[model samples]
Target: MTNFDRITVDPTVMSGQPCIRGMRLTVRRVLEALATYSDRNELAQEYPELEDQDIKQALEYAAASLDDRVLELN
Candidate 1:
């Protein structure tokens, strides 16, 4: 599957949070990890279920989601 295809959402999983390959790992969770860990390698060691492509695509997907939104400053 394409890296983007690795992202999926199901109400039964993670209470409908966006997840990777229908697994318990949510995209948001991974993105948050990026904040604490500077190296992707450390992330891999932390979450063995994650592949490089999974991390790349999750960022792509999250960025795309934000691009679709509009934020206004008051």
Candidate 2:
């Protein structure tokens, strides 16, 4: 498994959803925000605590989560 140090998951946090640096912010939220805000500056302004590394890791984590899998076609 790829190491995603920035991404943390805790049952007490966001119902165990993948989060950024154990923060209240979930990976899903970050992805949603990225989609909503095309500009990185705008995203930073909205989430000042979020660092570039965090964003990158979140994207990586998300992709890795979906990268390995087996699908059965009906």
Candidate 3:
């Protein structure tokens, strides 16, 4: 697994959902935001606390999570 140093999971935060550096901002949310924002500058304007590395790790973490999982087709 890739080192997701920026991704964190704390039961006290967001019900243990994977987050960015233990912040309330979730990896899922980051992915969603990425889809909404046309550019990194726009994303940065929206989430000032989020750094470039945080975004990078969030993407990496999401990819790793999917790679480690299996889903049966209905």
How accurate locally is residue 11 in candidate 2, as Cα lDDT from 0 to 100?
Answer: 100
Model 1 lDDT tens row, 1-74:
34579899899999999998889999999899888789978877889898888888998898888746679999
Best-fitting candidate, scored by lDDT: 2
Per-residue lDDT of 45 in model 1 = 86
Compute the lDDT of residue 69 as modeled in candidate 3: 55
What lDDT would candidate 2 get against the real structure?
A: 0.91
TM-score of 2: 0.85
lDDT of each: 0.87, 0.91, 0.91
Error of 1 at 29 (Å): 0.5
> Which ranges of candidate 1 are over 4 A from the true structure?
1-3, 68-74
Error of 3 at 34 (Å): 0.3
Considering only N, C-alpha and C atoms within 3 Å, which residue pairs clash in candidate 3?
none
Model 2, position 20: C-alpha lDDT score: 92
Tell me the number of clashing residue pairs for each predicted model: 0, 0, 0
Across 1-74, the per-residue lDDT of candidate 2 in tens digits comes to 66899888899999999999999999999999999999999999999999999988888888877867799999
How well is each residue in 5-73 modelled by candidate 3, as lDDT tens digits? 888999999999999998999999999999999898999999999999998999888877774658899
